[model samples]
Target chain A: MSGAGHHRNAELQARVNRLLDLAESRGVITRGQVDARIEAFGDRVTARNGADMVVRAWNSPEYRERLLADAGAAAAELGHAGGGYSSDIRLHAVANTPTVHHVVVCTLCSCYPLAWLGPPPAWYKSEAYRSRVVRDPRGVLREFGLVLPNSTEVRVWDASAEARYLVVPQRPPGAEELSEDAQRDLVTRDCLIGVAVPRLPAEVSR
Target chain B: MSFAVGDRVRVLTMNPPGHNRAPRYVRGHVGEVVRLVGDGRFPDESAVIGDAARREDIVTVAFAGPELWGPDSHTGDRVHVDLFVSYLEAVGERSDGGRTR
Candidate 1:
């Protein structure tokens, strides 16, 4: 069934399109300019760039250290910073260990690490998930079918400021033998977000 | 502008006029700043005017579960939230005590 929020968003989109059309007709805005703006918006946050950063951190300890020490520069080193809508937001990387895990959330709104991880999924923006995760992270993770061992410490990072965060999941065992490109393929978006760890070939086969 | 990394501060719950990055669930909670994350143009003013707002220092804050959820909350479990300078107030100086949740 159609929901009120969805309907409102559709109406807003229509209004924006009409305004754009009028602006174009009046010579105030060009179609090419509008297309460029739309393209910019889409390119503003990209997951592929983020995945590359994760892969680099996985392979280069120096880059990883720099990422942990100063995330903004680490991202800039790869040409992922300073995009539209993302100019103000900063990115941070958190490394996971055998005993600890990290997850990202935006309790108030859908702020995400677009520079490194791309746009957030629909589930990330839902009020149900947002409101519940901060209060009961383990229970919510359980709902996602991620049951953590009692000994594991689950750290939740609430992305509230213009600053955003990405999880640097530990490289899976046996990944050492794989080429960097192959290893990058293993660093999925979920791995970057700390929802799942990088899967080894054997694990993937299973 | 008012708080820095390592400073202990509490979130204010008042209805702020502009874009706010603070979560409602964490309003009135006390936390310690873990990292000074640099600054950015504030969102509130930027949204109104097409121009980028002036940059302010951003900080990463660490909050113990007990401070947010009382004594029954898991001991030693902590959460980190990145906050803008405007969303926070000094712990004892304000009378409202960040109650807006």
Candidate 2:
């Protein structure tokens, strides 16, 4: 089923590219402008920069406090806050501890924190995920292969309002020995989404 | 529309003709109001034809896993969902009781 879905998606993408080429030739929208727009959009919503903020917070307590208190300003301090549709949207940071974990979903539509995190993955927008995550969070997380202890609370942030949430995952043990750049590399998008925890060197290697 | 931070409220399942952000899983499920997030322009009527939604006061509701799922869920686990005002309907202490918010 997954393979078929990917094949269909690839075919649709080819069709879209063909349409885009025809549109550009017809002078409907310039290819240069479209390229520029895609670039601008990418810069505005890419999650790589947001991961940097999380890494910085992990290394610094002061920044973490600021980020938790006011995520929008904290992101702007790193020159990654405001963008295309972010003028009206606010970002919220939810920290995870040994006792708590955070995940985000949009039940109604695919409302996402595009400013901090780039466009959401296609899986995040799927009706199956969006419907099930809110109803059965643990089941959904388990499907992602994340099995939390019974004592750990799983917090699911619904991105319904103009606000978006970014999960601040707990720093793994032995991370203090690593450099800031190394630490940043461990903080993948899945970690920020609360599906997967940050890995140590051994875990990464395995 | 007006409830304390810890007040338990059930989300209404209204199939109105507009852009609503409430999820199907949470509709009719009771949860505690965790935070009284300030108002913003509502999104339901705005995103229909490309009009930007104005922000409205939205409350963050926290639900225990047992309440949402069943007793088989993790004991101490809870999920926090940010819900708009349109998605909620207040339930009192005398109402049908099952989940502790």
Per-prediction DockQ: 0.58, 0.58
Q: Give the number of the best model, judged by TM-score.
A: 2
Q: After superposition, how far is residue A161 of candidate 1 from its true place, in Å?
A: 1.8
* Top-lDDT structure, candidate number: 2
Q: What digit string (tens of lDDT, one per residue) describes model 2 on residues A30-70?
A: 87898898897676667677788899899889999999999
TM-score: model 2 vs. ground truth: 0.85
TM-score of each: 0.81, 0.85
Q: Candidate 1, residue B50: CA error in Å?
A: 6.7
Identify the runs in model 2 with alpha carbons over 4 angstroms from their true place.
A1-4, A14-28, A40-45, B48-55, B95-101
Fnat values, candidates in order:
0.68, 0.66
Lowest summed-lDDT stretch of 10 residues in model 2 chain A?
Answer: A1-10
On the 0 to 100 scale, the lDDT of residue A101 in model 2 is 84
